[model samples]
Target chain A: MIPVCFILIILHAYVNKIAIYDSFVSGAKEGIITVFKIFPTLLGLMLSVAILRESGALNFISKIFLPLAKIIGYPCEAIPLTFMRLVSSSASTSLILDIFKNHGPDSFIGRFVSIMMSCTETIFYTISVYFMSVKITKIRYTLAGALISNFFGIISSLIITKIFFHY
Target chain B: MLSYLWVSMILFGILFSAFSGNLSGITSAVINSSRESVEICLTMLGVLSVWAGMMKIAENSGLIKSLTKKIMPFLKFLFPKLDKESQSIKYIATNIIANMLGLNWAATPAGLKAMQELQKINIDKKIASREMCMFMILNMSSLQIISINIIAFRSQYKSQNPSETIGPGLIATSISTLSAIIFTKVFEKIYFKDGDQK
Candidate 1:
């Protein structure tokens, strides 16, 4: 997919008599600057996430959501992955792997986490990185909207998993 | 808002660790996390530079303009405040297209560029504009036509049918994306309405 797009872009640029090399260099420079701009924000978020994880605060928070998971018929073990999914994809993927190791990928918990992971994103990470690039500190209702959408995603994942993966 | 979240995360993390007598754990986490952040930035540097360059070539070729023109009406409605011919729309469209293609690595650079363009037009430099908020929401709840990573993981785990989750994944993501759009529009109406009334 990427190769196709790259080839098409280069072909189109050549046909249009565009100065591809110079444009690429300039854009690459912009990309570097953007990385620099968001570095601090990323650092802060990662630090907090690390601390939250090591301190067991994340587990505690997930425990609070246990009743909700129970009501929805989700496995208690998968709660951490759902919460971590909002924070970091890599972290959630590791947690999902752990669940798979213990419960088998075809089990209810494994399928649930798989669908949940695929359906949502690392919300806070994306928001901070994108907004920080723009130097926008006040995000308005973006957080609320993203979280609500994620909630719907989680609910839908649970319902769909039950309907499709019923054993 | 971000500041509040950051502060609370740090503060609560410290307090919780202190109360639980896990100060040693928190200390190591803080140290390790900074290193991991640098690693992440380095990885992003490579991906972003390459994709940004490609997008620039596309932009210079006028491909972005043509693409933006094709999607102008929908773009205009979604971002009424942005100028029709602005460079931001092109970046935004590129980001959306990459996201739809499930090319997350390619999407990030375009998303960042789009945000930068949006920031250029921002009346208040520190505050997010309505369009910016909407764009962020859309990006966060990006609808995936195919979740490549999940399929790979499922196959690795030896699932009988690795692709079985694709249908359910698509349906869930679509609902999430639709909800994101609706919530953004609803918030825009409620929040921006007061500004118009004034």
Candidate 2:
């Protein structure tokens, strides 16, 4: 799919007589600048998240929410990944890998985490970095809205996975 | 809001470790995680640069403009306050297309550029406009037709059918994206009743 898009883009550029190389160079430069612009926020966010993980704060929160998971028929083992989904994709990915490693990929919990991981975004990370780049200080209700939708994403993932996997 | 989240995470980490007698773990994490953050940025650097370059070629070829025109009515409904001829609309459309195709590496740069363009026309320099908020919500929800990463992960783990999750993932993501758009509009109505619309 990506290759098809790339080919179509190249064909379009050729047909339109566009200066593809120079445009690419300029855009690449802008991309580098954007990375640098958001680097500091990414650093601070990752560090805090690492501390949270290493300190077992996430586990503590997961434990606190165990009853809620039980009520919804969600796997207790997958709770950490769902909690981490809000903060860091890398952390959640690692947790998903761990779940797959421990329970095997074909297991119900394994499939559930894989589906859930793809359904949601790293909300806090995206919000901070995106807003920081544009220098938007007052976010208003964006956070609340994103979090509420994320809640739906999580719930729907569980329900959908349960219905499909039937475990 | 971000500041509060950042500080609370750090505080909770410190306080929890102290109570659990694992302060040393936090110390090591603070040092090692900073390096991990740099590594993550470096990985993103390669992907973003390549995809951003491709996006530029697309823009130069007028693909983005044409795509924006095709989706203009939907964009108009979503961003009612934005001008019909705004350049940000093109960028937003490009970002959405990239995201839908599971080209997130390409999507971030366009998304950032779109936000920058939106910022240019913003009445208040520091505060986000309604359109900006709506765009961010859409980007965050990210309705995916194909979740390439998950498929790759499943295949790597030797799933019998790695693509099995695609159907469920699409349904779940669509629901989430719709809910996000609705919640954004609802919040705007409830919270910004008397504020400047533009």
Candidate 3:
């Protein structure tokens, strides 16, 4: 898919008589600047997240939420995923694969994780990177809206999986 | 908001490690995580630059303009305040299209570019504009039509029908994107009433 996209883009650029090499170089420079701007923000966010994870704090919190998740009809196995999804994308993805391994990809829990992963974004990671890139520290209702939408997205994932997969 | 969240994570992590007798874990983590962050950034550097370069070609070739024209109505509905021909709209359209195509690594540069463009017209440099908030919200509520990675993982794990999740996944994301739109619109109406009165 990626290779195809590159070829198509180059083809279009060639057809349009664009200076592909110079354009790419300039754009790559902008990309580097962006990475430099967000590097500190990403480092800080990752440090805190790493500390939380390595300290077993994330596990403790997941345990605390496990029962509430069950009572609310969320799959118990997805407790860690629900929390990690907000903080980190890679972690939640690994959690999903774990579910698939343990419960089989065709199982209800596996299906739930797959659907949930598709619908939800890495909320904190994305919010920080995008806002920090623009130096917008005074965030307003963006957090609330993101959390609310994500909450509903998860709920809808639950409903869809249950109705379709008979979980 | 981020400050508080950052502080809480640090405090809770330290205290919890103390209670859990995992002080050494946090020690290694604190020392190592920053390095890990750098590693991740370096890895992203290549992918981001490639995508940004491609996006530049797309922009210079008038592809983005054509695509923006195609999605103008939808973009206008989401960001009503922005001029129809604004450059930010073009970036936003590119970002949304990249996201829908499941090109996440490609999406970030475009999204950041969109944010930068939006910031140009922003009144308060420190505070987020309504359009910025809306764009962020849209991003958070996933828009991918095909979760290729998830399907590949399922297939790797030998699911009977690896692609079967596509239907439910699409439905779930649509519902989420819909809710994101509704919530963003409501928040815009309440807080940004009468042209940035707040």
- Clashing residue pairs in all predictions, respectively, total 0, 0, 0
**Native-to-model Cα distance after best TM-score fit, residue B139 in candidate 2, in Å:** 1.2
What is the clash tally of candidate 3?
0
Q: Which is the better candidate, 2 or 3, if ranked by TM-score? A: 3
Colliding residue pairs in candidate 3: none
Name model 1 segments beyond 4 Å from true: B194-198
Q: Write the per-residue lDDT of candidate 2 for residues B1-198, one digit (tens) a residue.
A: 778888999999999999999999998999999999899899888878888889999998899899889989888889987787888988899998888888888889988988999999888888888888999888888566787887888888898998898898888888889999899888788866776564
Stretches of candidate 2 off by over 4 Å are none
Between which residue pairs do clashes occur in model 1?
Answer: none
State the displacement of the C-alpha of residue B186, model 2, in Å, after optimal TM-score superposition.
1.1
**Model 2, TM vs. native:** 0.96
Number of the top TM-score candidate:
3
Q: lDDT of model 3 at residue A42?
A: 94
Off by over 4 Å in 3: none
lDDT of 3 by residue, A1-167 (tens): 78888898899889999899999999888888878888999999999988988988877888888877878788888888888999988778888889999999998888888898899899899989998888888889889988988898899989999999876
In candidate 1, residue A56 scores what lDDT?
92
Residue A77 accuracy (lDDT) in model 2:
97
lDDT of 3 at B136: 94
Which whole-number lDDT from 0 to 100 does residue B113 have in model 1? Answer: 78
CAPRI band for model 3: high
